[model samples]
Target: MIERFIELGQGYGDLYEMLEIMKTNQERIHNTFVFVSEKDGKKVASFAVAMKPVGDSKFMPIYICREGIPYNAEKTSQRYDLFKEGIEAANKILITLEVKHSSAYVETTLYYQYLIGLLRLYHYIPNLG
Candidate 1:
Protein backbone atom coordinates (compact mmCIF):
# COMPACT_ATOMS: atom_id res chain seq x y z
CA MET A 1 0.00 0.00 0.00
CA ILE A 2 1.12 3.55 -0.67
CA GLU A 3 0.76 5.83 2.32
CA ARG A 4 1.43 9.58 2.30
CA PHE A 5 1.27 12.50 4.71
CA ILE A 6 -0.84 15.48 3.66
CA GLU A 7 0.43 18.42 5.67
CA LEU A 8 -2.23 20.96 6.61
CA GLY A 9 -0.02 23.30 8.62
CA GLN A 10 1.02 24.04 12.18
CA GLY A 11 -2.07 23.88 14.43
CA TYR A 12 -2.98 27.54 14.41
CA GLY A 13 -6.41 27.43 12.72
CA ASP A 14 -6.20 24.74 10.08
CA LEU A 15 -6.81 22.11 12.73
CA TYR A 16 -10.55 22.53 12.42
CA GLU A 17 -10.35 21.47 8.80
CA MET A 18 -8.44 18.35 9.78
CA LEU A 19 -10.98 17.55 12.45
CA GLU A 20 -13.86 18.00 10.03
CA ILE A 21 -12.20 15.71 7.54
CA MET A 22 -11.98 13.03 10.20
CA LYS A 23 -15.56 13.62 11.19
CA THR A 24 -16.81 13.27 7.65
CA ASN A 25 -14.68 10.23 6.97
CA GLN A 26 -15.11 8.56 10.29
CA GLU A 27 -15.69 5.15 8.82
CA ARG A 28 -12.51 5.36 6.80
CA ILE A 29 -10.49 6.60 9.76
CA HIS A 30 -8.13 4.11 11.23
CA ASN A 31 -5.92 6.16 13.51
CA THR A 32 -5.66 9.64 14.93
CA PHE A 33 -2.15 10.51 16.07
CA VAL A 34 -0.12 13.20 17.74
CA PHE A 35 3.57 13.25 16.98
CA VAL A 36 5.56 15.11 19.60
CA SER A 37 8.98 16.53 18.93
CA GLU A 38 11.25 19.18 20.39
CA LYS A 39 12.24 21.85 17.95
CA ASP A 40 14.56 24.51 19.35
CA GLY A 41 13.84 23.04 22.78
CA LYS A 42 10.14 23.80 22.43
CA LYS A 43 7.72 20.93 22.75
CA VAL A 44 5.43 20.80 19.73
CA ALA A 45 2.99 18.29 18.38
CA SER A 46 1.76 17.37 14.90
CA PHE A 47 -1.72 15.95 14.68
CA ALA A 48 -2.47 13.31 12.08
CA VAL A 49 -5.47 11.40 10.80
CA ALA A 50 -4.69 8.05 9.23
CA MET A 51 -7.30 6.61 6.96
CA LYS A 52 -7.78 3.27 5.31
CA PRO A 53 -6.96 3.07 1.62
CA VAL A 54 -9.77 3.98 -0.72
CA GLY A 55 -11.18 1.19 -2.84
CA ASP A 56 -8.28 -0.25 -4.86
CA SER A 57 -6.47 3.07 -4.70
CA LYS A 58 -3.56 1.99 -2.50
CA PHE A 59 -3.01 5.60 -1.53
CA MET A 60 -3.67 5.96 2.17
CA PRO A 61 -3.56 9.56 3.21
CA ILE A 62 -2.23 10.54 6.62
CA TYR A 63 -3.47 14.11 7.03
CA ILE A 64 -1.56 16.32 9.43
CA CYS A 65 -1.35 19.57 11.28
CA ARG A 66 2.37 19.75 11.62
CA GLU A 67 4.00 20.99 14.84
CA GLY A 68 1.75 23.33 16.77
CA ILE A 69 0.37 22.26 20.12
CA PRO A 70 2.57 21.19 23.00
CA TYR A 71 2.94 17.52 23.82
CA ASN A 72 -0.50 16.38 25.00
CA ALA A 73 0.63 15.00 28.34
CA GLU A 74 2.79 17.92 29.46
CA LYS A 75 0.48 20.76 28.57
CA THR A 76 -3.05 21.43 27.45
CA SER A 77 -4.24 23.87 24.85
CA GLN A 78 -7.64 24.69 23.38
CA ARG A 79 -6.71 23.36 19.96
CA TYR A 80 -5.35 20.14 21.35
CA ASP A 81 -8.42 19.78 23.50
CA LEU A 82 -10.58 19.98 20.41
CA PHE A 83 -8.56 17.23 18.79
CA LYS A 84 -8.80 15.07 21.89
CA GLU A 85 -12.52 15.60 22.10
CA GLY A 86 -12.96 14.75 18.44
CA ILE A 87 -11.12 11.48 18.91
CA GLU A 88 -13.12 10.62 22.00
CA ALA A 89 -16.36 11.40 20.24
CA ALA A 90 -15.34 9.10 17.46
CA ASN A 91 -14.73 6.41 20.08
CA LYS A 92 -11.09 6.15 19.05
CA ILE A 93 -7.97 6.86 21.01
CA LEU A 94 -5.36 9.26 19.77
CA ILE A 95 -1.92 7.67 19.66
CA THR A 96 0.91 9.92 20.74
CA LEU A 97 4.48 9.22 19.65
CA GLU A 98 7.79 10.92 20.24
CA VAL A 99 9.79 11.28 17.07
CA LYS A 100 12.81 12.92 15.50
CA HIS A 101 12.15 16.25 13.88
CA SER A 102 12.12 16.92 10.14
CA SER A 103 15.11 19.22 10.56
CA ALA A 104 17.19 16.09 11.03
CA TYR A 105 16.65 15.24 7.38
CA VAL A 106 18.24 17.13 4.51
CA GLU A 107 15.03 16.98 2.48
CA THR A 108 11.37 17.12 3.48
CA THR A 109 10.57 13.99 1.47
CA LEU A 110 13.07 12.11 3.58
CA TYR A 111 11.24 13.12 6.68
CA TYR A 112 7.95 11.82 5.31
CA GLN A 113 9.61 8.60 4.20
CA TYR A 114 10.99 8.15 7.69
CA LEU A 115 7.52 8.59 9.17
CA ILE A 116 6.09 6.11 6.67
CA GLY A 117 8.71 3.59 7.73
CA LEU A 118 7.89 4.17 11.36
CA LEU A 119 4.19 3.69 10.66
CA ARG A 120 4.82 0.42 8.89
CA LEU A 121 7.08 -0.76 11.70
CA TYR A 122 4.27 -0.08 14.14
CA HIS A 123 1.84 -1.90 11.80
CA TYR A 124 -0.33 1.19 11.52
CA ILE A 125 -0.13 0.94 7.74
CA PRO A 126 0.11 -2.08 5.54
CA ASN A 127 3.41 -3.16 4.00
CA LEU A 128 4.15 -2.87 0.29
CA GLY A 129 2.30 -5.34 -1.86
Candidate 2:
Protein backbone atom coordinates (compact mmCIF):
# COMPACT_ATOMS: atom_id res chain seq x y z
CA MET A 1 0.00 0.00 0.00
CA ILE A 2 1.20 3.49 -0.81
CA GLU A 3 0.16 5.89 1.91
CA ARG A 4 1.22 9.47 1.32
CA PHE A 5 0.81 12.90 2.83
CA ILE A 6 -0.71 15.56 0.59
CA GLU A 7 0.26 18.92 2.05
CA LEU A 8 -2.43 21.55 1.59
CA GLY A 9 -0.36 24.48 2.87
CA GLN A 10 -0.13 25.82 6.40
CA GLY A 11 -3.24 26.07 8.53
CA TYR A 12 -4.72 29.40 7.57
CA GLY A 13 -7.43 29.93 5.00
CA ASP A 14 -6.43 26.51 3.71
CA LEU A 15 -7.87 25.01 6.88
CA TYR A 16 -11.42 25.55 5.65
CA GLU A 17 -10.61 23.49 2.59
CA MET A 18 -9.52 20.64 4.82
CA LEU A 19 -12.83 20.74 6.67
CA GLU A 20 -14.72 20.70 3.41
CA ILE A 21 -12.77 17.66 2.25
CA MET A 22 -13.95 15.79 5.33
CA LYS A 23 -17.55 16.85 4.96
CA THR A 24 -17.71 16.09 1.27
CA ASN A 25 -15.96 12.74 1.44
CA GLN A 26 -17.54 11.52 4.63
CA GLU A 27 -17.91 8.03 3.26
CA ARG A 28 -14.22 7.70 2.39
CA ILE A 29 -13.12 9.47 5.55
CA HIS A 30 -11.02 7.19 7.71
CA ASN A 31 -9.87 9.56 10.43
CA THR A 32 -9.33 13.19 11.32
CA PHE A 33 -6.09 14.14 13.03
CA VAL A 34 -4.40 17.09 14.67
CA PHE A 35 -0.62 16.94 14.70
CA VAL A 36 0.95 19.32 17.16
CA SER A 37 4.58 20.26 17.11
CA GLU A 38 7.02 23.01 17.98
CA LYS A 39 8.99 24.68 15.26
CA ASP A 40 11.83 26.92 16.31
CA GLY A 41 10.26 27.19 19.75
CA LYS A 42 6.92 28.24 18.26
CA LYS A 43 3.97 25.99 19.01
CA VAL A 44 2.03 25.00 15.93
CA ALA A 45 -0.45 22.41 14.69
CA SER A 46 -1.18 20.55 11.46
CA PHE A 47 -4.67 19.45 10.56
CA ALA A 48 -4.99 16.14 8.77
CA VAL A 49 -7.69 14.09 7.11
CA ALA A 50 -7.02 10.43 6.37
CA MET A 51 -9.11 8.80 3.72
CA LYS A 52 -9.70 5.17 2.89
CA PRO A 53 -7.60 3.59 0.19
CA VAL A 54 -8.91 3.66 -3.31
CA GLY A 55 -10.49 0.49 -4.70
CA ASP A 56 -7.75 -1.98 -5.65
CA SER A 57 -5.29 0.92 -5.74
CA LYS A 58 -3.86 0.47 -2.27
CA PHE A 59 -3.21 4.18 -2.15
CA MET A 60 -4.33 6.09 0.90
CA PRO A 61 -4.13 9.86 0.86
CA ILE A 62 -3.60 11.72 4.12
CA TYR A 63 -4.30 15.38 3.54
CA ILE A 64 -2.66 17.92 5.81
CA CYS A 65 -2.18 21.57 6.46
CA ARG A 66 1.32 21.50 7.82
CA GLU A 67 2.37 23.22 11.02
CA GLY A 68 1.25 26.86 11.02
CA ILE A 69 -1.39 27.58 13.62
CA PRO A 70 -0.32 28.71 17.03
CA TYR A 71 -1.05 26.15 19.72
CA ASN A 72 -2.50 27.42 22.94
CA ALA A 73 -4.62 25.55 25.43
CA GLU A 74 -5.90 28.81 26.84
CA LYS A 75 -7.21 30.14 23.58
CA THR A 76 -9.56 28.56 21.07
CA SER A 77 -8.86 28.97 17.38
CA GLN A 78 -11.63 29.13 14.86
CA ARG A 79 -9.71 26.90 12.47
CA TYR A 80 -9.22 24.24 15.07
CA ASP A 81 -12.73 24.64 16.35
CA LEU A 82 -14.19 24.17 12.91
CA PHE A 83 -12.20 20.98 12.49
CA LYS A 84 -13.30 19.67 15.87
CA GLU A 85 -16.94 20.43 15.16
CA GLY A 86 -16.73 18.83 11.74
CA ILE A 87 -15.28 15.65 13.16
CA GLU A 88 -17.90 15.45 15.88
CA ALA A 89 -20.68 16.13 13.44
CA ALA A 90 -19.31 13.32 11.32
CA ASN A 91 -19.40 11.04 14.37
CA LYS A 92 -15.62 10.88 14.52
CA ILE A 93 -12.98 11.81 17.02
CA LEU A 94 -9.84 13.60 15.99
CA ILE A 95 -6.69 11.65 16.72
CA THR A 96 -3.98 13.88 18.10
CA LEU A 97 -0.24 13.34 18.40
CA GLU A 98 2.71 15.43 19.46
CA VAL A 99 5.46 15.06 16.90
CA LYS A 100 8.82 16.46 15.94
CA HIS A 101 8.75 19.38 13.55
CA SER A 102 9.20 18.57 9.91
CA SER A 103 12.06 21.04 9.72
CA ALA A 104 14.04 18.68 11.91
CA TYR A 105 14.58 16.44 8.94
CA VAL A 106 16.81 17.24 5.99
CA GLU A 107 14.01 16.60 3.54
CA THR A 108 10.26 16.78 3.87
CA THR A 109 9.96 13.29 2.50
CA LEU A 110 12.11 11.99 5.30
CA TYR A 111 9.95 13.76 7.80
CA TYR A 112 6.85 12.15 6.37
CA GLN A 113 8.51 8.75 6.37
CA TYR A 114 9.31 9.20 10.02
CA LEU A 115 5.70 10.09 10.71
CA ILE A 116 4.55 7.07 8.73
CA GLY A 117 6.68 4.86 10.92
CA LEU A 118 5.25 6.44 14.02
CA LEU A 119 1.73 5.96 12.75
CA ARG A 120 2.33 2.30 12.04
CA LEU A 121 3.96 1.80 15.42
CA TYR A 122 0.92 3.31 17.08
CA HIS A 123 -1.37 1.37 14.71
CA TYR A 124 -2.81 4.61 13.46
CA ILE A 125 -2.37 3.22 9.97
CA PRO A 126 -1.97 -0.30 8.72
CA ASN A 127 1.51 -1.67 8.24
CA LEU A 128 2.97 -1.23 4.78
CA GLY A 129 2.47 -4.26 2.54
Candidate 3:
Protein backbone atom coordinates (compact mmCIF):
# COMPACT_ATOMS: atom_id res chain seq x y z
CA MET A 1 0.00 0.00 0.00
CA ILE A 2 1.17 3.52 -0.77
CA GLU A 3 0.33 6.33 1.60
CA ARG A 4 1.04 9.98 0.89
CA PHE A 5 0.48 13.35 2.40
CA ILE A 6 -1.48 15.69 0.15
CA GLU A 7 -0.82 19.19 1.42
CA LEU A 8 -3.60 21.67 0.75
CA GLY A 9 -1.81 24.67 2.28
CA GLN A 10 -1.17 26.21 5.66
CA GLY A 11 -4.07 26.25 8.15
CA TYR A 12 -5.64 29.40 6.86
CA GLY A 13 -8.44 29.54 4.33
CA ASP A 14 -7.33 26.14 3.13
CA LEU A 15 -8.42 24.56 6.43
CA TYR A 16 -12.06 24.76 5.36
CA GLU A 17 -11.31 22.80 2.23
CA MET A 18 -9.57 20.09 4.26
CA LEU A 19 -12.59 19.76 6.54
CA GLU A 20 -14.90 19.52 3.54
CA ILE A 21 -12.81 16.74 2.07
CA MET A 22 -13.09 14.75 5.31
CA LYS A 23 -16.84 15.31 5.50
CA THR A 24 -17.33 14.32 1.87
CA ASN A 25 -15.20 11.22 2.24
CA GLN A 26 -16.45 10.31 5.70
CA GLU A 27 -16.89 6.64 4.83
CA ARG A 28 -13.35 6.41 3.46
CA ILE A 29 -11.92 8.28 6.43
CA HIS A 30 -9.51 6.11 8.37
CA ASN A 31 -8.16 8.56 10.95
CA THR A 32 -7.81 12.21 11.79
CA PHE A 33 -4.47 13.51 13.08
CA VAL A 34 -3.02 16.65 14.59
CA PHE A 35 0.76 16.97 14.58
CA VAL A 36 2.00 19.53 17.09
CA SER A 37 5.50 20.91 17.09
CA GLU A 38 7.57 23.79 18.34
CA LYS A 39 8.94 26.04 15.61
CA ASP A 40 10.87 29.19 16.41
CA GLY A 41 9.78 28.72 20.01
CA LYS A 42 6.09 28.90 19.12
CA LYS A 43 3.71 26.00 19.41
CA VAL A 44 2.02 25.07 16.11
CA ALA A 45 0.06 22.18 14.69
CA SER A 46 -0.79 20.46 11.42
CA PHE A 47 -4.19 18.91 10.87
CA ALA A 48 -4.63 15.90 8.62
CA VAL A 49 -7.27 13.39 7.63
CA ALA A 50 -6.18 9.98 6.40
CA MET A 51 -8.38 8.19 3.90
CA LYS A 52 -8.49 4.46 3.26
CA PRO A 53 -6.76 3.12 0.18
CA VAL A 54 -8.81 3.31 -2.98
CA GLY A 55 -9.95 0.07 -4.52
CA ASP A 56 -7.17 -1.60 -6.54
CA SER A 57 -5.19 1.62 -6.62
CA LYS A 58 -3.93 1.25 -3.05
CA PHE A 59 -3.47 5.00 -2.78
CA MET A 60 -4.21 6.30 0.68
CA PRO A 61 -4.30 10.08 0.63
CA ILE A 62 -3.64 11.91 3.87
CA TYR A 63 -4.85 15.46 3.48
CA ILE A 64 -3.01 17.99 5.62
CA CYS A 65 -2.91 21.61 6.64
CA ARG A 66 0.74 21.99 7.53
CA GLU A 67 1.83 23.70 10.76
CA GLY A 68 0.18 27.09 10.57
CA ILE A 69 -1.92 27.45 13.67
CA PRO A 70 -0.56 28.93 16.85
CA TYR A 71 -0.98 26.36 19.65
CA ASN A 72 -1.89 27.29 23.18
CA ALA A 73 -3.24 25.26 26.07
CA GLU A 74 -5.04 28.21 27.62
CA LYS A 75 -6.91 29.06 24.43
CA THR A 76 -7.05 27.58 20.94
CA SER A 77 -6.96 29.53 17.73
CA GLN A 78 -10.05 29.86 15.57
CA ARG A 79 -8.57 27.58 12.94
CA TYR A 80 -7.83 24.83 15.44
CA ASP A 81 -11.23 25.20 17.02
CA LEU A 82 -12.82 24.90 13.61
CA PHE A 83 -10.89 21.72 12.97
CA LYS A 84 -12.03 20.19 16.27
CA GLU A 85 -15.61 21.15 15.50
CA GLY A 86 -15.43 19.54 12.09
CA ILE A 87 -14.11 16.29 13.52
CA GLU A 88 -16.87 16.22 16.11
CA ALA A 89 -19.45 16.98 13.48
CA ALA A 90 -18.14 14.17 11.33
CA ASN A 91 -18.20 11.78 14.29
CA LYS A 92 -14.47 11.21 14.15
CA ILE A 93 -11.92 11.22 16.96
CA LEU A 94 -8.98 13.61 16.81
CA ILE A 95 -5.58 12.15 17.53
CA THR A 96 -2.86 14.61 18.45
CA LEU A 97 0.85 13.75 18.36
CA GLU A 98 3.81 15.89 19.25
CA VAL A 99 6.51 15.58 16.62
CA LYS A 100 9.65 17.16 15.25
CA HIS A 101 9.12 20.39 13.39
CA SER A 102 9.26 20.39 9.62
CA SER A 103 12.21 22.74 9.69
CA ALA A 104 14.27 19.98 11.26
CA TYR A 105 14.29 18.19 7.94
CA VAL A 106 16.18 19.50 4.92
CA GLU A 107 13.24 18.79 2.60
CA THR A 108 9.49 18.81 3.06
CA THR A 109 9.31 15.33 1.55
CA LEU A 110 11.60 14.05 4.27
CA TYR A 111 9.36 15.53 6.92
CA TYR A 112 6.37 13.74 5.44
CA GLN A 113 8.26 10.47 5.30
CA TYR A 114 9.09 10.79 8.97
CA LEU A 115 5.44 11.40 9.78
CA ILE A 116 4.37 8.38 7.70
CA GLY A 117 6.80 6.18 9.57
CA LEU A 118 5.54 7.43 12.92
CA LEU A 119 1.95 6.79 11.86
CA ARG A 120 2.78 3.29 10.79
CA LEU A 121 4.57 2.57 14.05
CA TYR A 122 1.52 3.67 15.96
CA HIS A 123 -0.74 1.58 13.69
CA TYR A 124 -2.54 4.72 12.70
CA ILE A 125 -1.65 3.86 9.10
CA PRO A 126 -0.59 0.62 7.47
CA ASN A 127 3.00 -0.44 7.06
CA LEU A 128 4.89 -0.55 3.77
CA GLY A 129 3.82 -3.24 1.34
Let me know the TM-score candidate 1 reaches against the reference structure: 0.93
How would you encode candidate 1's per-residue C-alpha lDDT over 1-129 as one tens digit per residue? Answer: 878889988856689999898888888898988888888888888899999988888889999987767764756888889999989878888888899988889987899899889888998778888
Question: What are the Cα lDDT values of the candidates?
Answer: 0.86, 0.85, 0.91
Query: Which is the leading candidate under TM-score?
Result: 3
Candidate 2 backbone clash number: 0
- Model 2: per-residue Cα lDDT over 32-92, one tens digit each: 8888999777788888888898678799999999987787757968888888998997888
- Among all windows of ten consecutive residues in candidate 3, which has the lowest summed lDDT? 11-20
Order the candidate numbers by lDDT, best to worst.
3, 1, 2
Clashing pairs in 3: none
Deviation from native of the Cα of residue 59 in model 3, angstroms: 0.8
Name the top lDDT candidate: 3
RMSD of each: 1.3, 1.2, 1.0
